[model samples]
Target: MMRSACALAACWWLPLSVPAAASPASAAEVLPPVIDVAGSIGIVTDYRFRGISLSDTHPSVQGSIVATHRSGAYAGISAYTLNGFGELGGSNLELDLYAGYRHNIGPVTVDAGLLYYAYPGSSGGSYEFIESYASLSARIGPATAKLSAAYSPPQDGLNGNGNLYLAGEVALPIRSTPATLRGRLGRSSGDTPLTPGGLYHEWLVGADYELGQVTLGAAITGTDIAAAEARAAGARPRDTRPTLSLTAALRF
Candidate 1:
């Protein structure tokens, strides 16, 4: 589960607007709750999660839709193409369901969530799992800093008592420009649904250009997974190496 969450962690840093779902109140009254609905569709040179290719180094189509409440609660679903490398019991698609809450306190934001990963038509393999996570974020000068931790309890497809992951990210917006620079670092401990071994690290550096409701992005992502580990896990070692990616997405 932690592995699944780490794979989609890139979505965490987006600065989404929170509009009021209810009417405004007088100065002496409390603000009413609000609701927001957002969705996006995109194509990527490769579907990389935690710096490993889930699309067999091939391009993939991805999309997500989320509904949020002004009170800081949200639920959403995401789906993406999967390749042989994803090892989803022969399934060619991956769907994720998630629910979470986020709250702002002063200049800092705190969040927690649960995610369920599903691979339909999979059999005789560890394919479905769940994870829980918590995170904190704050603006630091021109950059936003975030730290998160996620855990998965012992379940099918995982070894031992599951996995733990810690990650941090920094996002910087270029002054007067539509581009934002981002960097991520993460560490994984315990057995992952994909990798049944020791600890590993993942890293990514990227930039995104926003054009109205569309975004263009590219990144260099890599992981310190060894050949032996990949072999034991039935994964490709090359998939863990630094890879270049270009992506375009439309938001609605």
Candidate 2:
């Protein structure tokens, strides 16, 4: 759990893999894609990635543009404004370019991909890295569950050390309503300049409601990262504090 990587893992980009429905806001709905080119924009009270706050407890805007093939191949870019972690030594935004393939194996949906985290306008520092990940997901009764793993090899962003993350999530829909309840658990371990030798455990529980093309969300997220370690790594205590966030998003 390097300092830099810790924030990045605050939440898995695909927390509960359910095709077009597996997004952070609709974790329980397993709706397959109905459109080829999808675009979305949203705002979050605090942008926390695997349980760490990346927005310094402030709100942030985020959006993504993705194109998916009927064969399950897709590519996209996602970005958000940032205020902490000295991204690029004080750069205030984070962008990700990613591509991947998804396939159904009987009752299970499998996804594999690569993602590159990029910071613009930061020079003379290690500010970018690539991660590879895969996930397995399936529908179980009235809910869906996912298991995922991500790895980043020794790279400049990681200061020549590797990082690993394992995560799981489950989402259940409310009866006869466009609402969902979701929960997540994850563990991260690694060696890097940010955290030296670090290990962390994190969890989240949340719910979301859909209204036409708009979605509303709220979550309570926390992590078991030691205060001593966080301070030693130059991270704020709020990163490990239980946080409540409200969100709204528009999809098209």
Candidate 3:
């Protein structure tokens, strides 16, 4: 368990899967530090990650308070809005939150943490279910390599199942230009394969361009989605199309 815990910490520092920093705020309002300080607030016009619309058809308010030090140890909370629950009016609007930490060992890093996903308004009162994630990674030259996994066990409306997500990617900078390209492939598995409880695979191949506070990226994911409603509506194949997503984010 200790080894696994450390491997999980390694996953956080490896740039391949880590999120970038936000726009700089006033020094008087907020102090920025190297290997210190922990907190941030920002908004994204759209919040889509790994081909799924995390904040569909609406703007998202995001906040994070995490800081890493020379020792590479840190902790923080990341929260965002969840538009839908994969069903029509099944649950009210939802919001998700996760707290993570990382520790470094030589060239390797480990990350681990618990995550909470909740729903508020509409149907039932505001409530949320929880999950967990652990990952490990290493770095080499300008390329940082990583292999991370997460387990979200079964729960009430979340279905009695857990998922294991495995992914790896590399990132490199473009000389003289403020841009980076990254490629990743990830697959998820669980107990069942349906609606909000299906085991499936996902692939992500994307790149991002960063200019100061604004950054943009695009990626595509392929999966099998059952379109029974479309089929019943006489829409060609019963299988839905693959998932493709493009994202533009600004941190200010």
Candidate 4:
């Protein structure tokens, strides 16, 4: 499962006071730009990854820190608490390291990144894996739409199998209000421990209200996996059931 975190982009401009006789080159010899650092912490009613619950339908705490450069390169680390099910070898923590670059071409914004998932203090075997993702997004009227794909190459952690996830999302901001409506539809295919059924569809409809640096969100999320399929996958009954989740997050 991935922890969704928002980072505040920042840019700094310093005014350099020069003498009247100073040349233009002397004014340009100021300090180099600094990297922007942003952080966030939040709590969720349930820790969901893709369509499955990693926290066994329980609440989870998550946090993240990201550093961004002016050149559109960014790196971040995030962690969340989970139940540490069989797939995780009883490890209760999920940590992710990711880096990517974002660029704008005409009216479209492109983002590509690599993410590494690590389960610390896990036993039995390694539960680490890597995935690469790319996305293109554009603004349409008051709504923003994006299409993304994530792929994991065949590796030992996945038992020599690979996985692919494709998704589309749309977010609309209410005019003259602090609320935003969001929706997503996703499909997961291929072999992976997360989806024992080999394929499944997940969907989410959510809304978020901003209150300064704090934001409150509520969502209804569910997957198409049947009860039997979920059980057979070592997942709890609630994993496949339509559920409501509440979150309170603070960004800085």
TM-score on alpha carbons, each prediction: 0.82, 0.81, 0.62, 0.84
Candidate that would win on TM-score: 4
lDDT, residue 93, candidate 3: 41
Clashing pairs in 4: none
Candidate 2's TM-score reads 0.81
Report lDDT (CA) for all predictions: 0.72, 0.71, 0.47, 0.73
lDDT of 1 by residue, 82-122 (tens): 77643446558788898888888899988889999887876
Q: Which ten residues in a row have the lowest lDDT in candidate 4?
A: 1-10
Candidate achieving higher lDDT, 1 or 3: 1
Per lDDT, the best of the predicted structures is 4
Candidate 1, which segments miss by more than 4 Å at Cα?
Answer: 1-3, 6-33, 85-90, 237-252
Global Cα RMSD, each model: 5.3, 8.6, 9.5, 4.3
lDDT of 2: 0.71
Q: How many backbone clashes are present in model 2?
A: 6
Q: Which stretches of candidate 2 lie over 4 Å from their true place?
A: 1-35, 85-91, 193-197, 237-252
Q: Among all windows of ten consecutive residues in candidate 2, which has the lowest summed lDDT?
A: 4-13
lDDT of 3 by residue, 131-238 (tens): 577676676777677777766566544445455666676776677887776766655555522122244444555566775655565444433434553233221221
Q: Which lDDT tens digits does candidate 2 get at residues 1-252?
A: 233322111111232246663566574355444336666777787777767777777787887777776667777888888775554564577888888888889999888888888878866787688988899989999999999998888998887887788999999999999999989998877875434227788888888888877778878887887777766766543343444434443344
Question: Tens-digit lDDT track for model 4 on 1-252?
Answer: 222222222232344467777677875565334566777778887777776777777788888787777677888888888874655565588888888888788999888888888878777765678888889989999899999998888876677778888999999999999999999998888866656587889888888888887778777788888877777766543344444434444334
**Ranking of predictions according to lDDT:** 4, 1, 2, 3
